[model samples]
Target chain A: NAGVTQTPKFQVLKTGQSMTLQCAQDMNHNSMYWYRQDPGMGLRLIYYSASEGTTDKGEVPNGYNVSRSTTEDFPLRLLSAAPSQTSVYFCASSERLTVYGYTFGSGTRLTVV
Target chain B: DQQVKQNSPSLSVQEGRISILNCDYTNSMFDYFLWYKKYPAEGPTFLISISSIKDKNEDGRFTVFLNKSAKHLSLHIVPSQPGDSAVYFCAASDTMNYGGSQGNLIFGKGTKLSVKP
Candidate 1:
């Protein structure tokens, strides 16, 4: 089974452009998260969903929006891309906080110019 | 301000030797700590973790030690191999009151480990 998968492994967008990054997990985990990795910065949480139909803002949620329609899918949308938005995005899923570790997707590298 | 910190930006060790990575956190409420390893173009993988109640936890060649009083934790790898070369991140989690949710993790800048053969 594919544990976690992200679509559009690589993308380039001009300033003011818009796009969506898709995340899907076959693990049926209750928790899903989106994080962005920048140079010299570890990983910052962009958004998260505790379960289907629930979403919450994270540390760096300024320019991103997320929706969790199903237990398996949580997508992140970029309404207006900027050069500062260029970074690698990762999706992760976990069964629970204390019992299981997160399973992360390969990651999507986005470049905004 | 970064609640978690990894002072060492990088570390190098010879193969078959022991490798130790250090981490510290400023938040006293953090109860759970974890370590993750990442390779180029790949996502980070969980390596080990420890609860505040415990001082040490071990899995195979990897061991995690937590010192609550000092607000410091460390990951130790014995007989390190070249394959162990990767970036290591330290993360912390605490409990939150909102809906009784477990707090989101706060991560530190990672330390890149290089195991020479």
Candidate 2:
């Protein structure tokens, strides 16, 4: 099964450009998260969803938005993309709010020039 | 300020040796800890986890040791193989209450482990 899938494996955008990172999971998980990974900074949660139609901010949510419109899809939107947003993004899901059941996607590497 | 820290940026060891990755946390409230492994061009995958109630947990070649008193935890991979080389991240959560769910993990910078043949 495709546990978690993130599209647009790689992208480069100029400052002020906008883009959305897509995440889809077939595991029917009730929780999904978006995190950004930088060289010296580990994955920092940008946003998360507990279930469909619900979303919340995480540690670093600035300049990014998320929507959980369906049980299988959670997309992360980058508004006014800046060089500071250049990093590898990951999408993860779990059956519930637990650490043991976390499943991560392949990830999308985004570069804002 | 980073609540969780993996001071070591990278580590290298010969194959079949033991690989020890260290992590420290400043949050005493953190009750659950997890270790995730990530390779180039991939997302971090859950490797192992431990709760405050446990001192250690092991699965096959991987083992995690937790010292609550010190707020420190470590992951040990015995007989390290080349395939095990990756960036290891340490994450923790303190019974977060979020949208009727309890899973919000704070992560460390990560330590890159390289296993040489």
Residue pairs in candidate 2 whose N, alpha carbon or C atoms collide under 3 angstroms: none
| Candidate 1 per-residue lDDT over residues B5-78, each given as its tens digit | 99999999999999999999998988888999999988899989898999999999999999999999999999
The TM-score of chain B in candidate 2 is: 0.94
lDDT (Cα, 0-100) at A8 in candidate 1: 89
How far residue B3's Cα lies from its native spot in candidate 1, in Å, is 0.5
Off by over 4 Å in 2: B96-103
CAPRI quality band, candidate 2: medium
Model 2, position B73, has a per-residue lDDT of 98
DockQ, candidate no. 2: 0.65
Candidate 1: which pairs clash?
A: none
Model 1, position A59, has a per-residue lDDT of 86
**Lowest summed lDDT window (length 10), candidate 1 chain B:** B95-104
Q: Is the docking of candidate 1 incorrect, acceptable, medium or high quality?
A: medium
Tens digits of per-residue lDDT for model 2, A37-59: 88899988898888888898888
